[model samples]
Target chain A: MAEPTPELIQRAQRGDPESLGALIVGQQQYIYSIAMSVLRQPEDAADLTQEACMKLLRVIGQYNGESRFTTWLYRLVVNLGRDELRRRGRRVPEMPPMSDDDGEVIDPLQSLADDDRWADPAAVATNTELQGEIRQALDSLEDHYRLALTLYYFEDLRYNDIAEILDVPLNTVKSYIRRGKERLATILASSESEKIQPPRTVAKSDVPVSQPRLARFAWALGRR
Target chain B: MEHCKEYRTNLALRPDGDTAELSQHAATCPECAKAAKRAAAFDTVVQSAVMPMVPDDLTARLLALVPGLAQPMVRSKRWLRQRRAFFAISALLSVIGVAVLIYGLYILGSYVGVSEIWHTQ
Candidate 1:
């Protein structure tokens, strides 16, 4: 979405109802998208979107225009999302440890070995099932990782903006996104294994010799 | 091997980052090239998955909330004016009521000789 013009923002800040209405109208979809990405439920996301609009109305005057307006707005939405999660008694889950006791970084891609299934850009780009798997994996991730990835990938936000919105350092933002993608790849690989495995009682007629051998080997290796 | 690790790490962290140096390294290394392809694929899938269609009525619903945007300041000013007028009127009435009560007490005291009782005591 295009950023609202400075004139419109100034008018809105001056309490011009028409300008405020226009501003909210322009940003509602963007707000809802972020809310949906965070909440992962249609009803909750919708409620959050409306609530965010109300909040913007109340706090528009407090915006000093030091940062990009959207960045400020994103911080508001993220904070609201965190509050909603807390109200529901769901603490934002902590990111899984990135290093072991030996202080060595655990490389998430180490497990993939020679498996190039996730490495095929064309397959991922065209496959609907893989897209669904990715969405599911994203939903399962911890809040910080999910938020970082959502802002970076979905909103096309820069690392600097994401870092500011997340209130973390630049490197931390990168770590959240990097680890988030790694975790997603891990989840997708496992789900693919489950789908590829056939029943033990399958007849020879049902089995393609080459297909099952490769499937079985990939599945076994993925499990290991 | 360490160079490959750095290349892969950079790819995983930022598939879209400026990678001229990394690209040069990947050109010489088949393993890093494969990793780059995988990172690109993963980034595509993630970008696709994270985007959701905004609800149709979201704009209308949010715009409806805008009417009250300027109302609070207007309403608060009017409220303050009304409250100040109210307090002033109440204070006047209170002063008048107190004076009347004191006058009535003095008259009753004179008629009943209660002031004399106090003076004598």
Candidate 2:
């Protein structure tokens, strides 16, 4: 995540119009990516992304500067997503308040941090039209779970960071990733094909190797 | 495959990489190990596939919708155009309000026989 400079943040806080615009442009992609990944239809995702931008402008003054500005910005987008879900009459997860639960909460991040998190930073397998298949499976999961995966996998946020943005417990974020993956596995299993090779491109720079959704694509094929 | 369930469950939990327990379990249990490795590989595919591909003009396009970010904070042309009706309504209301206030004051003065244009000073 690109941390906006303190000078930039202060300029935004001071309501410098240019600074505000800079802030929006800087975070637009991350917000758009999350919105696109979670929602099934591209149009809906586009609509929600626009809504989030307007929302940020409408409420920018309310930003207290207590939490990281990015977190606050994400929360705004998440809330907009929740609102969209509500409008569609789809069931959505309850949003928790963003209290100062920092160290006060029993974050199990440390225990898992050393082992689980470090297990396989880069995914190293793939084959065929795994992209569309994964998208289909992803859309099938519940909105909250999909949002969790979007944050954890795509946005590359930590469990606690996701929990903070979604305003849920860390365990809940962990549970969401686990369940979402399992559900995705089940859906992709419904279809099959062969041929394999990992994609040469992973826009993300942090991890050299990307995930194995194609492995699951083949893994799902093997089960059939 | 006894440890497979726990291993898979753990696989789902971690943000990146495999956990030590999962790695250890996979080491001894070939069935689960292979499955875990494959599953992890599939995870990589999922990440790459599911990534959102946005347009180069996405920021400009989306920022256009944001109320303040798209235009200047003060008296932007778009802002003026969007709020013209509002400003007009406000202006009308102010004109009416001043007229009513003057009329009311005139009536009050006339009733008390104080002063009026018709009655002179």
> Which has the greatest lDDT?
1
Candidate 2's C-alpha runs over 4 A off are A89-128, A193-224, B1-9, B15-36, B65-121
- Ten contiguous residues with the weakest lDDT in model 2 chain B: B66-75
Per-candidate DockQ vs. reference? 0.30, 0.16
For model 1 the TM-score comes to: 0.68
Candidate 1: CAPRI quality band: acceptable
Candidate 1 at A128: error in angstroms? 1.1
- For this target, which candidate reaches the highest TM-score against the unseen true structure? 1
**Where is model 2 chain A poorest over a 10-residue stretch in terms of lDDT?**
A105-114
**For every candidate, C-alpha RMSD to the true structure in Å:** 19.1, 19.6
Residue lDDT tens for model 2, B1-121: 5456656555555545466766788788875655555556666767765567666556666656644554533466888887997889999999999999999988888787674456774
Overall lDDT per candidate, in order of appearance: 0.75, 0.64
Best by DockQ: 1
